[model samples]
Target: MPALIVPTTRLHTAWLEAHDEWGPGSHEDGFGLRPSDEVDSPAGFAAWVARLGRESGQATIEAHRVHCTYRWIVEGDQVLGGIALRHGFNDFVQAAGHVGYGIRPSARRRGLATWALGRILDEARKHGMDQVLIVCAADNIASAKTIERHGGVPEGIRDTHLGPARRYWIKIGRTAT
Candidate 1:
């Protein structure tokens, strides 16, 4: 079974494999990758991973930044995908949502995204979030469906820096069906 795990240097090679499959782009959402991040070299990857942990450790929101928990989806030693659970809302979170996830192309049809989202929703609840905003590309049918399956209520489509996105809200602190 696939499990959510904290980002680790041990999975560097496996993580790179998944990263390469997405080709070259910052479009690999959920990994919290930025255009300026250099994850190619081992040292660079370690630094990037450290940054992720530091972001999560920031108890207080700073300026535009918010605490965010990052998790990798792994079954055994293979890195299949990643998910992010943002602790609070900000201008960026308003467009991106509190939860973002992506499964590698090879792992897309295995319900990994759905599974990861479910896991992160629990994390959000633990962090005292009453609800979470999740946004996906408006044209992404699979992501929309996955959200809906988890009791997400449609909040309509909105334009973001990344273009048109479908927004959803999932309530926490309640018994899940």
Candidate 2:
């Protein structure tokens, strides 16, 4: 099984491959580096890693108005996907929800996102969070179903600046199936 480990310098070497796998219009939401980030070379990617997460084995990153922790879903040496857990909910988070996640384009429809969220929910339990809010686009049935499979209850839809989105809440510490 893959594990949700904090983003680390050890995986910076995999950045280029992962970045290329995203393709056009893929979800770059939880990716620590932005489309504009300097990742031309290994050294540049390593430097980008410093500001995003898991520096020296811990997530000390502070961005997007929350104490955010960026984690990579990996199996052995391969970077499969990523998930973001925000410690605090801001106005933007209130509508977008607490958890944001994505699987690489090449690895989609393989049950990775659901599995990633399961592991992320375990991490959430450690933070003493009782429930986790997950948001997905109304048109994104795959994401919505993944959320539902994890016991996420629909909390209705909202028209946000990000467009129409569906919100859900999953109770933490719920036994994993």
Candidate 3:
């Protein structure tokens, strides 16, 4: 329950451990919900972290930017999950969201996803997002509950790159207490 969000570099070792634990292609079930690829490799992951640190500007499909990826850390050490806060309409409304996350399998059911998302929402508000969109697989009850617990209202369902996904939105101006 300590700070759930941290710099990806702060938990690089833990990120690698969680990736190993979840195995390849595990991160795909969340976010864009696609299999791990070259960008998911250890070195690629490090570069991604560096990009987040740069915060130079918004990213484009052809160009990348920093601050797009955020990691959820547990106990200020272990990485339980992460989300890529992509900018622009395509990312905001489709591929990614104001946030997306996944708890490591071994760490599931401990409310980490809930806590992680709550933290992410706060970040969204800080970024001036009035409402944040979060989408999860329709069958992912755990993720649905986590979203609901964080004040996400069922906005609708949509077919995404990963198949049927439930879309939820949370008003960032309000914090769950």
User: Which candidate gets the maximum lDDT versus the true structure?
Assistant: 1
lDDT of each: 0.85, 0.77, 0.62
Please list the Cα RMSD from the true structure of every candidate, rounded to 1 decimal place: 2.8, 3.2, 4.3
Model 1, 51-133: lDDT tens digits are 88844532223445877888989999999998988876788688788888999999998999998999989888777788999
Shift of residue 100 alpha carbon in model 2, Å:
0.8
True-vs-predicted CA distance for residue 112, candidate 3, Å:
1.1
1 or 3, greater by lDDT = 1
Candidate 2 segments whose C-alpha is farther than 4 A from its true place: 56-63, 173-177
> What are the per-residue Cα lDDT tens digits for candidate 3 across 1-177?
645443455466776687789775455333223233334566876565554442442233333222354445566577666555654355445545556677778878887777767766666666666787788888899889988987889978888777888988887784354
TM for every model, in the order presented, reads 0.92, 0.85, 0.74
TM-score of 1: 0.92
**Candidate 1 accuracy as lDDT:** 0.85
What is the total number of backbone clashes in candidate 1?
A: 0
> Best-fitting candidate, measured by TM-score?
1
**Candidate 3: global Cα-lDDT?**
0.62
What range of 10 consecutive residues in model 1 has the weakest lDDT sum? 54-63
Which is better, 1 or 2, measured by lDDT? 1
Better of 1 and 3 by TM-score: 1
